[model samples]
Target: NKVSGSNAYVKSCRRDGVTRWSDGNTVSGCDGGEAFVCNSQMPWAINDQLAYGFAAASIPGLTEQQRCCACYKLDFTSGPVVGKSIIVQVVNSGPDVNPNQFDLQIPGGGVGIRNACSSQWNAPSDGWGQRYGGVSSRQDCYSLPAAIRDGCLFRFDWFKGADNPTMVYSKVTCPAELVARTECSRSD
Candidate 1:
């Protein structure tokens, strides 16, 4: 289930609750899914079921499906993480983040410490957070977290432009060969 995609650096980050007039805050899962929406005019919301493994936003066009819920297989090219690959879920988009860069979900991505997120949020009980600027990576992705694997159901209300909404995400598992090559496990 390998797909062709470009390479990029991945950074760990947190999920925040937001409002139209003010950037609110939340330590728990997104308040009814609209929390990740950048635009108030949009009627859709991103279900934060996979908050731990999800990917934050980055510059557009890095990959055809870099948008919400887009999953990528990030193969580390150097550092202690070399030879390890992890699947990431795309959750947020950042304007300041340059292209070909992916902001991973902190400790959940197993790259850096997990501090940008609050304890009430997805931080693990050990209480460590990533302070590193970035983690190196090559291109690649699957597998759902406990919440989704526990029978979470989704209902997508389609619109004119969403002719390909479902396929936006790649739900394949990491190749057995890749998992066997390293001892690294997906944090969270």
Candidate 2:
């Protein structure tokens, strides 16, 4: 599918093996039927021009099971992140996600839809900022949990605070580092 404007956001992780449910049901590691984004799933830089991360996406013609652990290379074409690329592994699915859209898992990127950060990290009710978009500046990142603060900082430092940059994507082999983090691998 032709995907663009694949926005990135954070949704705390539960456990390594538990599959994310798009309906926002409680998985392992989170209490009260909340889904939490894992800190390990946070995007990290490989260099100035490249990086690796995880995301929740809806790829047309693919089942949620099929999208799990599948990796895609995104060639950003707009915003401050233009010309940069990031390899993202699908670890979750969003009910609100549109066809061919990916919601990247970036700390401090904002917890859209469901939120477990408050329960998981004692964060504010709406996370560090608005539920849909998140903290506006690097200084605002301090509001996030200390465990994920660096991941939040990544948005401003390595990512240049790019906002939902548009991009073209293609399937690629999952990187060893990403596989190690999610403990998932695609057979096909």
Q: What is the C-alpha RMSD of each candidate to the true structure, in Å?
A: 16.8, 6.6
Instruction: Itemize residue pairs with steric clashes in candidate 2.
Output: 11-37, 12-36, 12-37, 12-38, 13-36, 13-37, 13-38
How would you encode candidate 1's per-residue C-alpha lDDT over 141-165 as one tens digit per residue? 0122332211111211111111111
Q: Once superposed on the true structure, which residue ranges of model 2 sit more than 4 Å away at CA?
A: 1-35
Error of 2 at 61 (Å): 1.0
Count of clashing pairs, candidate 2? 7
| Separate clash counts for every candidate | 12, 7
lDDT of 2 by residue, 6-123 (tens): 2222233453313443333345333464455556778899999999988889999988867777899999999999999999998778777889888887777787877767777776
CA lDDT of every candidate: 0.31, 0.76
Candidate 2: minimum summed lDDT over ten consecutive residues — where? 1-10
Best by TM-score: 2
TM-score of each: 0.33, 0.83
Q: What TM-score does candidate 2 get on C-alpha atoms? A: 0.83
